[model samples]
Structure formats: structure tokens, C-alpha cells
Target: MFPNLELVKMVADIENPTLFSHDLKSADILFLDLIVSGGNINTLADFIADIPILIITSAISRWQYPEFIKNREHFALQKPISLQMFQSCIEKAIQP
Candidate 1:
């Protein structure tokens, strides 16, 4: 779908999340799964401060991450994501 985009997948080792870090400074966007990161969203959010992020979480209603909520560049998508919603979020995130 995103023909011009380059996607890189990284599996975070929950036991050692920091072990897989590799020059993410140049990445245009970040797709993160909150549950899989061992609830270390803040740390990862801070690391990619300037980049736009699409966060996936099962507990959408209970989410209280003010930092992400307040940022226009950050988007949260609930579990069982739909293609239309995903596409909309991607478009919004990439908008200037």
C-alpha cells in the first residue's frame, strides 16, 4: 500500500528492551505495541521525541498517557484494528 515507504520491523526483547536499538533517529514514523513493550511506553516515546508514532493498545479507554495524548504527532489505535481506521491514522500522522 505504501509503495514509497520503507518499513523496518524490530522485535523488542521484553527481558532487555534496550538490546535491539539501532539508529532509529532517522526513522520517519514508529509503530509501537504498548503491551509488548512491557509497558515502557514513556521511555520509547522519549527516545523518538520528534518522530510521529502510531500506538496500538487493547485498553484504549483506560489509556492515560498524557504525553502521547497531548501530542498531535502521536496516534492511538485500539485492538482489532480495521483497515479504514489504520489508513486514516497513517494519513493523519503523515500530514504536515
Candidate 2:
């Protein structure tokens, strides 16, 4: 399993992102999660023009967040995420 620090390192090497919105623009891969209630999901989605979004959440279904879940470029990363899963999500989202 990849450590959180390693994940951060991987992201760091790719490009420096100021906000979640900027990250989406610079990177083909984007991981969006709600550390709280997923309320920001819609806001983030709105900022993402065409980038794919990998969402991590404890919510069982997409209905939990209506605005963000309707996107085809979106993927769900259920909580208790594994390293392989996270990496795969990243790859899939970023792959052109």
C-alpha cells in the first residue's frame, strides 16, 4: 500500500497545484473528495471544464451528491481506499 506522503510526493512531482480547480487544468487526473459532507463537489465540478474527476467518499451511492455524480468523467472511490485502487483511479482519470 502506498503511504499518504508518497502519494503527495507523486502529485508534487507532476505539477504544483494551487487549488483543486488549478490541479484539474494542469493534470488530466483529479481526485475530489469531501473531508466533510461533499458539499463542495458541485462547486469543484463546475470549475473543471473537461478534466476527469475521481471522487473519494464514504457515500454508498452517487445520489449523495447530485451535481458532481452526473458527470461521465467522474469515478467513485469508496472510502477505505487502497493504494492500488487509488493509483488505478489516478491512471484512469489522467489517461488521455
Candidate 3:
């Protein structure tokens, strides 16, 4: 478990990204859900500073989106992710 993990905030719907925009800028890691990310991950990523890692959770294929290309340090996780897969992604994201 991430004992030192401090969750910034959770948005059920990112209709108004400005509400959480500030938090994203200062966040160490970003857990992005394509469904709830207002379908503008690119814009969101651009708005934020250089985030170390981005964990993308989506049902869409990675090839379909340009997030992977835009953010080299990102992990694409399918919708129904297992605990192990999630852990691996986190570990990979944090790796130097």
C-alpha cells in the first residue's frame, strides 16, 4: 500500500476542470480517467506543469489517443484493471 500517498482530490465529473485545475498543477502523480477527464487529456496535460507520471485509465485503446505520444511518461490502463496491474503501473510510473 502507498502509506505516504496523499490523495489531492477526486472529481466525479470534470465538467469544470478549473475547479481541480489548481490541484493538478501541483500534483506529483495524476490518475487520469478518460471518461471523467472531459475527453481533453491533451489540454489538461498542457495546462499542468511537468508532471512526473500519468496513470491513464480508459477503455479506449492507447493507439486511438495521442496522450501516449504527448506524455512519454504515462501508463495506459484498461477499464477493468486488476490490483496487480495497477500496482505495476504505479511502480513503473515512479521509476527513474
Candidate 4:
């Protein structure tokens, strides 16, 4: 889990989540949004390591599984997630 600013800094640009994704080679968990179709899948996948990818998106998002991200069996969230659901997702992710 991204616990603090330093943890975030280790994985992604603190200001621009889209432009960078921390250092995946050493990362354990990743959270990103697949909002655009085709445009970002490749780059996003390049930053993924053998980690649990938690993607935020609704069913309406058109992004396909690019080869880079294809190998990762990620957890996808639909839009309008409830607070309880959000917390549960995080808890589960953090739990072994």
C-alpha cells in the first residue's frame, strides 16, 4: 500500500500519476486508472511488475488489456464506489 508521501514517491510522480508509475521493479502494489483507451495501456504496463494492480474504472472505460498489462490479474472497480467498498478493497489488498 502507498502509505505516505515517501511511499508514493517511490512508485509514481507525486504530482502526475499519469506520467509516471513509481519504480515497478521494486514495487509491491499499484493503483492506477485506465481511463483512456489504447493511449496509455502500453506505458502503464511498462511500469507494472509482478504486483497486484488495482485499477479504478467503470464499465464504460474502453481501455483494452495491452500485452504489458495483460499478464497482471488486476482488480477493477466500477465507478461510484461506496466508501465501504473502497475501504474493503484496500484492506483486502493489504492483507496477506
How do all models score by TM-score?
0.67, 0.53, 0.78, 0.55
* lDDT value, residue 60 of candidate 4: 44
lDDT of 4 at 69: 51
Winner on lDDT (1 vs 2): 1
Q: Global CA lDDT of candidate 1, please? A: 0.61
Please provide, for model 3 over 1-96, each residue's C-alpha lDDT reduced to its tens digit, 9 standing for 90 to 100.
877568988877665678878888888888777665455555565555467667778887877766444547577789899989888887787767
Of candidate 2, the 10-residue stretch with the lowest lDDT total is 5-14
Candidate 2 deviant stretches above 4 angstroms? 1-20, 35-39, 53-60, 88-96
Q: Positional deviation of 41 in candidate 3, in angstroms?
A: 4.5
User: Between candidates 1 and 2, which one is better according to TM-score?
Assistant: 1
lDDT of 1 by residue, 5-90 (tens): 57775766444435544545666777766565445556565556665455554454544554654464466777778888878877
**Full ranking by TM-score:** 3, 1, 4, 2
What TM-score would you give candidate 1 relative to the actual structure? 0.67
Q: Residue pairs in steric clash, candidate 2?
A: none
Clashes of each: 0, 0, 0, 2
Each candidate: what lDDT?
0.61, 0.52, 0.72, 0.53
In model 4, pairs of residues that clash are: 11-22, 12-22
Of 2 and 3, the candidate ranking higher by lDDT: 3
